[model samples]
Target: MKHFAYISLCLALCLLFAGCTRTRISSFRVETPEAPEVEGVHAYMEPHSATYRFSGSVTISPKETMAVSGSYVNYSSDSLMQQSRSFSANGYYEFGGSDVNASFDWFGKASVMLIGFGVGYDDGIYHHLKVGFNTSVVEAGVYLGLYHQYTTLEINGSTCDTWPCSERDNWGSMSETNTDFYTNLFYGLYASIIIDDFFMSYNLSIYNPSVSGGGESVSSPDIYSHYIKGGYRISKHWEVNAGLIMSFVDPDYRHFAANVGAAFYL
Candidate 1:
């Protein structure tokens, strides 16, 4: 009940925040003899063009606000046991970035998390565009990103227990696996800065609620996600990056990751 209330509140906030988002603002580019191109946080070259990069990251300490499996009390055996877990697998991502113009830059990232056994799997993508300005010490930008995550969950039995389990009554006499799939979309605002070989960026995203099963849609500001990162160039072709990424199942449920990765440029 508490979780449901929290989710309701968050959805309300998301709608409110989304209404405040401004349309993309256009600006004149700074003309130079040289055009700059970049891929992610690593490689930067002149005559800005399409940039390609490969990267790998590890998600550390992902908090599970909602359990992927189920559990219950078996009166037949007078025992308490857990069903199975489906969210223990590691998450991975593929990242890409490019300079759309002298004053505009765009970035894209795709991620996947799989737990096998047909238990759980998630695929997500994030895309952002920024208008930028530069100084001797830093390059700054105002950014907006759109993110979508598709998740599927499968659980076997234990339908009686509340939470961590699907809502159902089965008296432990009959049991079957249950599967559920859902999708979400989010919008974000961020500020990015680059200082020579080092860079730092952060974003705040709000959920964009939707209607399902003929239900009314919702609005929320409390429901949101966060991304923060820092990276440094090690060589002309290699770069190292680290960051924390956070997501929520609802206003009350969440997931978090501490990530470290490297980018190789073409």
Candidate 2:
């Protein structure tokens, strides 16, 4: 009986060792959980949205390289018209806008280049001072800001030589219409809509003179026409912009321009 007890104890020890070995082998054979596949598409397209941010963007566009169409005609207060049909190279300097702010909100855009310098009836320096707030067409807000402009046109020899009046008569009145530097205080309703890579904005601004100086000084008008602009984001911080600017006077003025520039946010 004692011998049988010893044999039984040995069999129990063997069974315990076999069970532990089987458990160890089961753990080792388990395959590592497959690693998740990361996607790059979402990463590339995310920056284009309103939520996508930019630090700043800067671009330099020279007008000398662009072919200018149309001519500039200078008219005297004395009822004389002179025309110059020469190609002009003009400079455009604009800073700060809704898009500029939006760009930096995500990343950033910075540009340091000569915008354009043209020899048209254009003001040597045409500036746009706009204060606006906007959301998706789904959201709209009102903003008020000053739109100031300093424009100078050198009397073209071809146009000025044919003046109907003497040099003195031409000089006095010609100076009035040739160069204009005025600032308009405008409060307006602005709205924007974003579709794909394009964005469009409409602003109906009431133009009033905040600082009336230089040029033909006249009391501000009661009302002015509305302006509309549309732009497309070509790259991270680069955009192609175009717009129509108009005003009412004895003779209404309408200007259409297309330009490429960089927008920067603060």
**TM-score for each candidate, following the candidate numbering:** 0.43, 0.33
Model 2 Cα lDDT, one tens digit per residue, 162-264: 2233334423222112345544444555455666557665555454332111211223222343445566667654555455433332143222223233343
Superposed by TM-score, candidate 1 places the C-alpha of residue 172 at a distance from the truth, in angstroms, of 22
Cα lDDT tens digits, model 1, 1-266, are 66456545644664666521111111111110000112233223333333345555554552233322111221121112333222121111111121112112233222211010001111343444444443334433344444333332222221222222332323232222222333444344554466778878666655432212111111222345566788888877677877776655445555565656676665
User: How high is the lDDT of residue 51 in model 2?
Assistant: 28
Question: Any runs in candidate 2 off by more than 4 Å, and if so which?
Answer: 1-139, 147-184, 209-218, 222-225, 249-266
- Separate clash counts for every candidate: 11, 26
What is each predicted model's overall lDDT from 0 to 1? 0.37, 0.29
- Models, CA RMSD each: 18.4, 38.0
Q: Tell me the spans in candidate 1 whose CA falls farther than 4 Å from its real position.
A: 1-50, 66-122, 126-128, 134-136, 143-146, 153-184, 209-211, 214-222, 246-255
Query: How far off is residue 76 in model 1, in Å?
Result: 41
